[model samples]
Target: MSDEERFVYDGAHVVDPLGDLEEEGEKSAKHNRAKVGSARPSSLLYTYGPGAIMDLPQFTIMPTGLDEWDRIWRRRGPTPPRIHAPRLRDVVRMTLRSPDVQLCPYPWQPKKHSRSPEGNDLGVPSRVFPQWLRCTGCDMLGLLSQFDYRNTHPYRTDLAVFEHAKCTGRAGSGTRKATRRTAIPARYLLACPDGHLDEFPYDLWVHRGQPCAKAELPALKMADRLAGKGASAVIQCASCDMRRPMNEAQGEAGKAKLPQCRGRHPHLDAFEPKGCPNATRLMLVGASNLWFPATYSIIVMPDSPEEKASDLADRVRTALGDKLAKYRDNLDLVRDLLGMGHVDVTELPDHDLELLLQAASVSPDTPAEQEQKLRDWDPVDLLVPEWQHLVRPIVGNRAEEPKSGLTLATRELGPGLRPEITRVLAVERLRKVNALVGFTRIDDMDRVGDLPRRLAPLTRTSRPAWTVATEDRGEGIFLQLDENAVAAWEKRVLDTDVWHSHEEAHRRNFERRFSETAEQVNHKTRLKPPRYWLVHTFAHILIREFALTCGYSAASLSERLYAWPAEGREPSAGLLICTTASDSDGTLGGLVQLSEPSRLQPVVTNALRKAARCSSDPICAMRTPQDPEDFLHGAACHCCVMASETSCERANRFLDRRFLIDLPGSGLGFFRPHG
Candidate 1:
């Protein structure tokens, strides 16, 4: 996908401020900002949340932090709909310790169209990022204010861009024929591990932090010594005749030359009050590690699964009673009438229309207060409730408890199936909720356990009451590993050197980064069991196979793992492979159909057989976590195991193909090498 196209859902275009609002079906949109591009509300929580740099085709913008957004929302006539994700809300509230925490989609402008300009403000308020800009035609460097702004199209906002009105081919030193050229953000940026970001000090760097004759208005020229090579560039000042290679301001020398961190958060337009003590590190813009969001997600579950007789059947009957009058007797024909929009209850075996017809019409609806309490939890283990609902079907008095966002069925572990996998669940229809708590820059907060130390707040100092999130609809397949096999394998591997080596590698890798505050969080990376690596690796393997045979790229599908051991609970080893999208109200049945016994059996066997030996075998299969320099993963490489960074949890770390198959020939493979 094109860079701009990848962030938001497909078909969403840049909001043109000059367009006919009524003609396009939008009653109102921003007329002032003339935003050259637009992002969907879901994208706000993922790639472009508040305090993230949104590099669009026309402009490099940062979603203004919560500080400025609060004022704009105060006048709110028509605001974004508030989403209810009780499972996710419970976790986020527990994490942030703010009981009033709410989850909301990104706000939209007033939904009223009129001649008055009282409220024409468009999507989330944003500001131009990287105040500095460079003229491509001439090497002259200056702030963005010096460039001329232009919106080429009346309604196509993506065409709006910054341009150097006049260009002297000779670095602005000559008065020759001048032509307009698009301006780009200066290549370099400064940031620290603690999440402080600032523009490269171009003026101070060329002069070595000393003022030149033209210090007030320096004529800085950034000349390239080599194309696509940052260090080869040279920054020169025309006034003082001072020049320095860009390499001098990088690596070890950079710490001495670059100023101490100002604790600035450009997205918030404020410097942190705590005042960072560490030296800022030099970085190039568009680097992958620039922003990393720490999000909490959960599958939407029947709201009252945990309670004894949640009365959810009555609640769903009440909810459906109003809408069911027309299709009362002929539920079989409901699917044809709804045209794939509605999930018919008859599709699930346990909840057929006949059963619903035999029960009472509708009892008193469950109280909203009591209904919410079932979704609430003091304990923060988010996976238990979901596991119970997925493994054991939740049944009500007459018919199964129903949720509009979920339709599920189980293809139980029956005769003549693979011994390793004991249960398979076909989640024909599912909804997932995601919430953004905080983000980090420069380095990733790989495991959720590291969140406390690594998370960067949205604002400079203040804590916001609510978080931005999105609810997605899709389908998936859930598989549970055999408990006996998993327990026996853990026992067999517990004393082996291979398991100890992998465990030690995790400790060393995690300690290498946060030795100063290792005790802050639980240190999940240091304590992951062998079962985690086994299940996580299998997910990667199966998804890669799914990509080749099922026509879905591994990147498009994501995995939700359930491996942590909670007190007084049975051994947990289950993973869900799902494809979710906000635009697709619900997905086609292709993914769910693949979960059928006839199809999935061969796919599982094929994925394992292929992973038994990588094309890069010997070099790939023989490798272990010990040989690498503190890097995690064993007997796994890009060719065989590594998945897309977006899909794999832990950013593809802690994976070991050797556990799944005996590539090393030491009798460690759980599948018995060639079984």
Candidate 2:
């Protein structure tokens, strides 16, 4: 039916937009279930995850919490099919404290006409939001139950909508003059920081704090003048003219006017028994802050030795074919057979022997297939694992070896490169996986480090054992700064007044944010080494410069900073600049071409030269943290070091172009400009 765009690929991988076209007049469409509409499965992870509001073509919806998911007829929630990304899963399990947690791609039904359960079930379930709606024809307003819903969507899905079918236009003080008109949702809603959402009280607003003086079941009407902003819109009671402007329901004015939250969760279709303690802020359906997803993202590591052994075991099984089936129950027999060199099997590692034993136990795949899933997870430190991959020698072309999703190769590092940049690598291919842990309202929760209450839940029931995820594929250029040069630079510049100011600002920002929540602050909350800022700022500058050379926009590209320096690992000061599914892509031709020796030399030089003086400079370069309340960035604005929030991991904080170039009195340029 629809070509749904799934996840927003952050260049860690290729974005998988799910679905095949539903052929017109297809026989199975006749067997279609009670489907209200469809959405891109990717949206479920990024844009429309559980508890987030969305405007479908016909009506508005808030997808139910994960507790209600199903494929059609099952009474219990669905155990969505698994998708492997073990490092990410372990991190989530450790964070949520559910040791056996799993990761899965968002569920879907590829076939529409099949009479089977999957085809019969709706992909994700949702409930109509803002229960109150305004009839577009007469401005008549009421709850969804009060309006008449019409569905011709089974045959004509787009036309499914609520209509004021009996509207004789403002069923008058004396007359009627209106035809049927489609109804639209009331744009306003109320939410608290605790993530409770509810319908705006139109009656309460129109009538002040009193009961409707005219009638008990008074009909309400909304009128938009279309001349100005929220102030121009008006609400009134049909029984009596108790009118109020829409602006009264916004900001502090609305916060003062509205009642305390009942702790209503529209997605769960229930209100908390004790009610919410925090005040509810008014939100429009389209507002950006209404829903924020807290997700864990990881670049898939190169296959581990154990995983490689699993692959070899499978190949041996295939070579042995039916002959291996008879020897399945005896582990010694299988090991000896592999030892006999019928399939070129090498000395099996303990990992391979374990897999072989499992294969021997269950005759290939029995119902107990999960017995084979026991493998050690990759390290929970995301960047360290990826850093290892980035630092390794890139694989040259090999026709005989099976193709991998990730193929990286080093470009010739000639004399052209700056001495500080150790090497240039062309990541011919890469994969990134993003998993939705939960969401929040009013605040953008931090996804890094150990912090409490960083996210709200996706389900109201038990802590979920599994969550939805999506993958993206892309290629990029990796630049590793000289480690000794960076370490020396940090020791020299870290104690300056300018650097101390940044450290103070970072401390204050962290305290002001987490203190109010009353959660314990980790002692590790101190500011990190200055090279992180250098590497992070460098990544942003290159993203902007590469847009001009690589034919991708500044927004399409993203940066993954490897700068988390705590006590044990090799000090990380590298970054990956990647993009997936861009208009300018010629596969490997775009990003990889820029990493070549001839092009890379000038590219890095020009990018640094450009950062030496921002267009907004003097003012931008001279900028610093002025007030305690505002301590996010320094010497970085839209004109220079600041990057698209989607690209930069830290929401554009801890950036200072001054660290990359001399800013008058501040002589902290890590890459001092050559005369």
Candidate 3:
């Protein structure tokens, strides 16, 4: 979906410059107000939760009060609560199984109560965080800590901030006073690279963290200069007669000037007893780098009976409901034993519990037979098993029956593209589950493999045991490339001097961004093989082509690569370009229609033809990876082979059109015309 369609307008965006209007003009004002309120649909409450900063038309808001989940649930007024206790419990179980992951549950405010006869209990919550607001009318910057729960209405916590103080900016009639004004979230926050977030230390910044003999309640003000830059912004302490520029609290030098992290988790209303040693940096609350969610995903394979076993477990859980909670301690043990073999009623020690366990382990094949069936599973790569399942011919097996979630069919390719392309699968329906394991700040996703200390939890409880997750459904086009053809092309490319230059440029870029230590540098030195480059470049071209023909936008479509190293047990190369949405049913059959042989042939031909010559012409085609303007890509740009960051799995890096089509200065094109 387009961002415009998803972006919502909070009521604060529609401010009336003119004060209170006359009685005759009130109708128009009311109509405008209603329109803005409707924009923030209740459905958003299901998608966003605390710590998640939602983009408003004017500013942003982080949904606070996740720590107050119990409080919110008790006071949930007329509108029924959206409860997912079962799903939440399941997610917690999954987190415990994955040792590398930490648990942090996203706030889920269901639209309606599960017990409600009219409501369905399958909805997920929105992940929007609340903000520390600053009132424009009285120029009062209020901290989230100052919010009084006594002022909270039964159902609406949003109104608590307005009750703090009435606006003093405008005059009132007789003994009356100015009306209440809404406050927007503060724009600035203090954070460390270790993912410790806290309120901007206005007092410590101005006082320089020294003991000041000033008034008990000192006044603090944030003034903006005409320059409209961080350097021009200043924070002042009236009592101490002190002031400091925001610029000094930014960048590398700012680390020395700022205070140490206090280890505050505002979203969960908690703090670390042991203070963090890392120095804090001034960061904009809405900065994209502040939150980088690390997610792990796997394609659902048909040949894998574990998929069916999982479904059966879910069915048993649903049937037992509250009764299943009692068996939580033995759930894993029961599941493991069930996977190995069926338990005989006569050999079972506990007769009463046998039925429940048997129901959960209802499978057609016996343990030994299932093991023998999987003996031929010689997967070439991590994704090879999934690719094999996609290409497999589906017949009359109940386990392999076409489900509503994912449906696939293979097709034959024409002679021209056949030598390079091995197989094509049209996916009619597919479901993707993205689990939020942990997050990092300042650092990129490359550091996900590091220790848990380097990552931040989604919730406040130290050493949490569960994390939140969401599922998306969609359609896709899958293609497999010939391993031999890819191997031959890779050998030719690696021998060329141009390939060596590309490798050196990649090395320089890596060292520049990361530490120079041998350990860090060596970890990233596994140079991307020519085969990866060839497949990655082709994926970009295909995505660009699919975006124009398919109804979905380029950003909505994402790529999944299946490639192997130079020396590996299995030699495999393939790509899956798919798009998914938060909605129940994924998308139209546009992508599936394009999977047809007649339709796919033209798309490939046009994409390759366009890649042969970019709009930038000889300059773009002749550019090398060593060029200062082009550090990662060669003979490629936005107008040619580059794609949106959301679409490319490699962050739009390690791509070169020369690998796909012949270029002016290089003869390393893998897809050059045979004639």
Candidate lDDT (C-alpha), each: 0.70, 0.69, 0.58
**Candidate 3 C-alpha lDDT tens digits along 436-506:** 54556776555433434555555444333335445567888889887878888888888788787787776
| Model 2 global lDDT (CA atoms, 0 to 1) | 0.69
Instruction: Write one digit per residue (lDDT tens) for candidate 2, span 1-675.
Output: 111211111222211111111332244443323456667654677678888888878678787766556332142243456666766776776555443467766556566453445554336766678789988778888998877776634546677688887777654535575467888888888888777788888888888877798899888998885843654679899898878988876667667778888877666665565667878788888778888888888877766876555545544654455666687666566667776645443466656566664653344322233222222222326778789877876547311112336667777776857788886778777777788878777877752222343356665543455677777778889899888888888888877887777866766666676665325554235465688888888999998888899977888788888875545666678899988641222254587788888988888888888887878878888777755645667889888778886678777887998888787878898886664
Error of 3 at 13 (Å): 30
- On the 0 to 100 scale, the lDDT of residue 655 in model 1 is 87
Model 2 poorest ten-residue lDDT run:
1-10
Predict model 1's lDDT versus the native.
0.70
Question: Where does candidate 2 stray beyond 4 Å?
Answer: 1-42, 72-79, 109-122, 151-157, 170-175, 209-213, 226-228, 303-380, 394-404, 447-454, 517-528, 581-589
> For all the candidates, what are their Cα RMSDs to the real structure?
10.7, 8.9, 10.5
| Model 1 residue pairs with clashes | 14-38, 36-157, 36-158
TM-score of 2: 0.79
Maximum-lDDT candidate: 1
